[model samples]
Target: MSDDQLFALANALPLVGWLALCLAPLARPALVASARVVAAAMAVGYAVMVGLALARAGGPAPDLTTLSGLARAFSDPHVMLVGWVHYLALDLWTGAWEAEDAGRRGVPHWLLLPCLALTFLAGPIGLLLFLGVRTLPGRRVPARP
Candidate 1:
């Protein structure tokens, strides 16, 4: 397949895992079934995307010491797609952690679902939103006298 097609495929792979995560333990009983999805995606999907990116000429030779340098490094379509998948893996991992932490803290499904969805869509925004939600005061346990 052409690099454009490969890029499209790379983008689609994470959506499947993110959708699976939407049915996370916090929201349903099928959580266990999808638990492996993100990790597997990270392992397989990331490798494939990175490999494709490296296939391009000079794709990995950028200085990468500054923002523009990083941008130039990823100017190649394949490398750009690899960069996207890199975000996907990091975002999904963070979303997974957020789900587990929210579950432990008794955050409601109504809230968690949106947060997870947002995280899947925009990595930093969702994490920031969830962190804000986490600041809501919870019932305090009494101290022993």
Candidate 2:
């Protein structure tokens, strides 16, 4: 496939995968079951896409398919995905922690779902949105006795 095709494919798979997860509750008997399926599918798809990108980037040989393939993949894709993934992962982790910390905050789960979706679509944007929404301004009120 051409670079354009690969780039399109790279972006489409994660977006579609997240959309699948977002809609899975309506399609399955159990939310946990749906989540597991979506997560597995996305992980595999992401791995393959990254590998292909690295190969196309001219860092490594495509034949390297295992952990041993790293030296090869590292040569081309330039590890660009790693930094994004790291940022996304940390953002999600902290978001969850902040949600837990909001004892009386009672933030809705729906509010978080979109942020999680965006993180996978574009890491930095998703993370910033998450933080911003979490810290949204509150209504002003007079002090109580």
Candidate 3:
């Protein structure tokens, strides 16, 4: 498939997981499992794209060390797609964890919905919101094994 088509697929893959997270609190296990599957699929795509980027002829190897080097590396659409998929996979994975963790901790599902939405849109910010919610008095529950 073309990179643009792959990009569209990658973007769409996590929406179901996110929607389930927000709307299906009772099906936490299934939701989490589905999120894992989606993230894994995205991760496989990411790995293949990375390998392709590395193997492509006549381009400087992707540089993650310096800001300018990183910018230059991401100038390639393939590398950008890899980065986008990385974010999609990890953010959706994080939202799944947040949903599971919040459910375990007895945090209200209503409270978690915003956090999940934030995580879907802006990963760390949503995590930060969830972490803050976890600190409220009486929100604590023993960590999962």
Candidate 4:
């Protein structure tokens, strides 16, 4: 597939998990499991794209050791797509974890919706928001023995 096609696929795959998390609170376990599967699939795609990017670098490979080097590496479209897929995979995985954790902690599903939306749009910010939300009074559930 063309890199652009692959990028589109990578972007689309995570939405299934996100939709399940947002729409099906009662199916947390299944949704989380499926999200992990989606993330794993993206990771495999990332590895393949990275390998292709490296192989296609006929001249000096993009250096990854410094900030400037990393920027230069990302200048290559293939490398940039690989990086984006990496972000999509990890962000979806993190969202899955957040959903499961929030469900376990007794946080209201309504409260979690915004956090999930934030996470879908901006990964760490959504996580930070969820973390803060979990700490609110009356949200905590006692640990099970």
TM-score of each: 0.75, 0.37, 0.91, 0.91
Model 1, residue pairs in steric clash = none
Tens-digit lDDT track of model 2 for 1-145: 6445544554454444455434433542243344344445545555775676656564434455686565655454335454333343344343333333222243345665676666655656766776676665662233546
lDDT string, candidate 4, 1-145, tens digits? 9878988898899998888888647788897888888888888988888787777768986678999999988887778889999999888888888888888898899999999899989999999999999999987787889
What's the best-to-worst order under lDDT? Answer: 4, 3, 1, 2
Ranking by TM-score: 3, 4, 1, 2
Which sections of candidate 2 miss by over 4 Å? Answer: 24-42, 45-109, 121-145
Residues 1-145 of candidate 1 have per-residue lDDT tens digits of 8768866776776666666666666454355235447556666877976665567455347778999988877786666776776777788777777776666666765787778878878878899888887667882334546
Model 4 scores a TM of 0.91
* lDDT (tens digit, per residue) of candidate 3 on 50-116: 8887777476555779999999888878878889999999999899899888878889999898998
Among all candidates shown, the one with the greatest lDDT:
4
Better of 1 and 4 by lDDT: 4
Worst 10 residues of 2 by lDDT: 95-104
Looking at model 3, the pairs that clash are none
- For model 1, the stretches where C-alpha displacement exceeds 4 angstroms are 25-36, 51-60, 139-145
Please give the clash total of every predicted structure, in order: 0, 3, 0, 0
Best by TM-score: 3
**How far off is residue 11 in model 2, in Å?**
1.2
Q: What is the lDDT of residue 98 in candidate 2?
A: 33
Off by over 4 Å in 3: 140-145
